[model samples]
Target: MKNRNYIHLFANCLITKGISRSVICDLQRSKYVLIPNSFADLFSKQRYYNLKEAPRIFDQENLSIFHEYVAVLKDHNFIFSCSKKELKRFPQLQLKFEYPAKITNAIIDFDKNSNTTIKDIIQYFLIPYNCRHIQIRCFEDMDSIFFDTLITEINHCFIKSVEFIIKDSFEQDYTQIMKWVENNRKIKSLVLHSSQENKVIQKENYGFGIVVTTRQKITSESHCGIIHPDYFNITIESYTESLCYNSCLNRKISIDKSGNIKNCPSMKQSFGNIKSIKTLDSIIENPDFNKYWTISKDKIETCMYCEFRYICIDCRAYLETPENIYSKPQKCGYDPFTNKWKWDYESFTK
Candidate 1:
């Protein structure tokens, strides 16, 4: 044999298995590729690679199939061939996940008759916590004065990124709303639901992303967990965290339209009324609050066997069996056993 070497997968290309297939998550590039279960078996040996042992992975008839998968893997830069000595120099990526803040993100919903004002909310919650991300869902058209005040006050808060979910306005030119989001440095997305038309707008600075969903009104948290591939998060932090912790509820807080704080706005339980809750610190410390934080995909039924578990966010509040804490997500329509993704009208709860 010539310069024989071992084969190695890059530290970031993590593979996860389902019952019938596998998902290759490219953490560095924020993408994922699905592969057959048989293709994943090529790595089961987990040893040095050489021409002599090629037969160990494939017989004469299956050699072409092995070559096909190898080609696909190489094309995506998921694997590399190295000398035997070089193998010892490479180490697998550490799979630990940790967030510096007590609460990492938040979702605050507002309706036409919300009890509190946006200014008070900023001063009370956003200013006190070091939350990195937030989602503001306005169920109805908002007052121009309050909207302007929120934009100005948000600049002084700890939220690094935000997404605004609002109903499209017919009273005012929606383009003007888009302009505000475009100029704001922290606003990542502006989703306009219940619109006349469906479109996605991304122009220059302030118009980074303005999504329109026709005939769809996201009035509450019940609209979550749609389970679309477009919503998957392939980041290293999200992937590793999904391995051990609940992706949706971990270090997350939500405040519904009625000012009731919860792990998710759709859930029945509330920590306290935002107006009366002394400190979020007390609520986060309560054992009843963090109970769902650790219920990861590995512990969830059906999802435990899916190859896309780590990349797909989990919804603890809405499940196939509400009585069972480990029930499968009702919004998920993927059939991992059949190696296909399909939406079943009867299966989707909301």
Candidate 2:
């Protein structure tokens, strides 16, 4: 496919970092569209009042009450930021991320133990909700019997698509995994994490109908359709960054581990919290939280003139705090804002 073929508009914002309904409402008035984690129930009971008109609606001591009012606005699936007091009003809300209904499939890296358990919790909770797809993390060294048992259990559960991470250094034979996938047509996608040799496998063996490479080393030439560390900018020298090109092309919901959710994993700040209001509907109705998704990258001054803006992954993590996200993510090689590299300009030019 062509470079622009994979262009995607991402709804950037995390509910956990604190964005309020009023703020989101203000943003919506400015013409921004949002994609919230929860659906709509979390904010249904609340009413809206102008900050100037209802100056005393909430006491200074109980700011959380005000937060609840704004959070209710967020149920509309908009994006905005709120405060601690506002977030407190929704005590049931936790610090988590939720995807929109349209996005039924997701691949989460179980980087932490909590992440692993979180997957199970999601599976249990979303089953009744009729979620269609899920791909869980699995270590390669685990026993084949364990994989078989896991596959059997997953097959028994309410799932349409399932994928297991194939690590590069795993001792298990890929043939076995491929065999299981072949038998289980329920699996629609397969991802290889940090696999250099497996890059060759996609071309040699046609067993995997759809294969994607999650780490950096594998490229488009390998026919491993997807690539990760997507939070960086792209250039001709780094063509592999386009791996997410077709995959996320028309995607509406985007997720990142940044504590604060905003457009792009590299951005700073957030719209609201997902756990505070456990349902996706709660996030859909909030007017205040809707603007982030609607705003185009071209409107944002920094991105408008950059040569790589259209192809590069705009990240909230780096924008939130450059030092913490990446010391040297690929796109960081040159800064459009300053027109200089963090290192020597001559070296980058050469």
Candidate 3:
């Protein structure tokens, strides 16, 4: 058999002790594998000289290994989850990429007494940036009034799309929700989230509104889609995770939300502060940060071998809570480790 030139490795806290041992053994056996951090730096130096070299192995191990290899690499890699002090040490760690305007949208979860006015914020932060759509989540007290105001504002600004996520408690006033949808016929998508009690409202009016039920219960008759947010858990193969990451990156949406902009909302590291820079273009210009974006499935260990590597989202959220992220989403019946879709089997096998 030909020597397997590629190997993908993915591990979280939940892997059996034996699994970790097996993975480490495999890494030791690879011919020219590159660890995670060093791979970033290697890519950066090559890019400067207009050279390209295929990195053999991508290591997705713990932070210790990442830090150890990073220290030795001459080039700087974009640091995810690093504090401002740490980033200052590597001032050359910035990179840039072309921004995608189509999918660059914003979601604002509104609470009472939020210092920022929703309309003003959308106008200033979203509209000027040419953001195509905006999703708003509001409390019950403000839903009715705010909904009207938001619709007026969207029309005034000629914004293309708007989605409102209302609390489930408002199921009784289904008519009002329908009326809003009816009035805004040009809106591309409208989704309503309701608790179990309000599920009936969704069923009664199937034409205008699409209801998403968060509750686990299955009603005898259902007309709308059900989304149990808790069911989104699952252990995906490393390749599958990389596929997801690449897909997200290709879309040009910034997921980083900690102190600095990185890849995902859950990652604690920052290459640089977005507030100070005011644009992703500047961040992407940094060579170190550019290397971070260039990281491919071949560079990451767990993503190398998995068959599903291209379809699933490599979630940093799962990395943060490995136990929960690795496990099947509470609402999902699939096992990530085994790459089995139990829900599909259970539904069809019977």
Candidate 4:
């Protein structure tokens, strides 16, 4: 029946068009599929098309490609068969996102010489402005006692999730790492950077678990942004937030290893020192601190044309043009115009 022959992509399937290619972002599954630009154009022009009307749209030669696309889309569950009247039931995906916390995420950089304490940070943040996520970056190899005290402090706090990034060493306490991760539901990921080998170790019960990354010797904030497909997060919250705010800097604040308070540790501008600032309220409230929070991908130069703009974690700290705030991330090697990555993109399975 022609009534049942209508085909439509689900609302969650966000088709982001590049110059020559398009990405079908499946928000529900946190995945994406690459499709030719022509296919994306067809889907946009006809939101819900009847199969009977396909013949007039495409010529004899290109009709086969259209059929192949339909089959592939159906198989991937990106689209579904429905009637024209049934289309109203599925409304458009909502792009507006509201985070429950005032400070959704924060980062605290540490080194052997660092003096800012977790106790100070906890009392500073308080429960009034709940920071949902916290990422702790350690430039030097920390002892087991460092985590012991930190975890004990977190156990009594209201923080939702904690990510630990430590310098890899020959004598890493795997036993303690696994023990802490297994016990705490809030401990999301433990990353060992500058490692000899690259691997992952996580269980079904544990949070994202431990990750070892090689050649990632992060001494200072200079080693911040490296755009890779592995870092992409295709989630509803991220997609909606990217529409309005900077994907990486929005609602984010940080304290560098030197006790300087900043929007991001990599940024040269410092609001104030953590030691001098009272409760971080003064710094976050400052208008200058929130300047780059609204610089979304839409305003970014080369990123605006990228299909991965919504999902890719953007970096404003290091730009191709250092003086230009709107310049693209220098580390990003992907060119949307040619639909090519600088290196061989072998990691792309889908």
Superposed model 1: Cα runs more than 4 Å off: 1-4, 45-51, 203-213, 344-350
Which lDDT tens digits does candidate 3 get at residues 104-183? 55555455544445465554455556776665554334546766776777777746666655555554556766666767
Tens-place lDDT per residue, model 1, 164-258, is 88887744366676677766777877777877777665543553455444557666667776776777899999999998999899998888999
- Residues 48-97, candidate 4: write the lDDT tens digits: 66788789888998899889988988888899999878877877887897
So what's the TM-score on candidate 4? 0.92
Better model by TM-score, 1 or 4?
A: 4
All candidates in order of lDDT, best leading: 4, 1, 3, 2
Clashing pairs for model 1 are 182-206, 182-207, 183-206
Q: Is candidate 2 or candidate 4 better by lDDT?
A: 4
lDDT of 2 by residue, 48-126 (tens): 1234423355466445554564455455444334433443343322213234443344433332222133334355434
Please count the clashing residue pairs in each candidate, in the order shown: 3, 67, 30, 0
Q: How does model 1 fare in lDDT?
A: 0.78
For candidate 3, what's the RMSD? 17.0
Best by TM-score: 4
Q: What's the CA error at residue 161 for candidate 2, in Å?
A: 3.9
Clashing pairs in 4: none
Rank candidates, TM-score, best first.
4, 1, 3, 2
Prediction 3 global C-alpha lDDT: 0.40
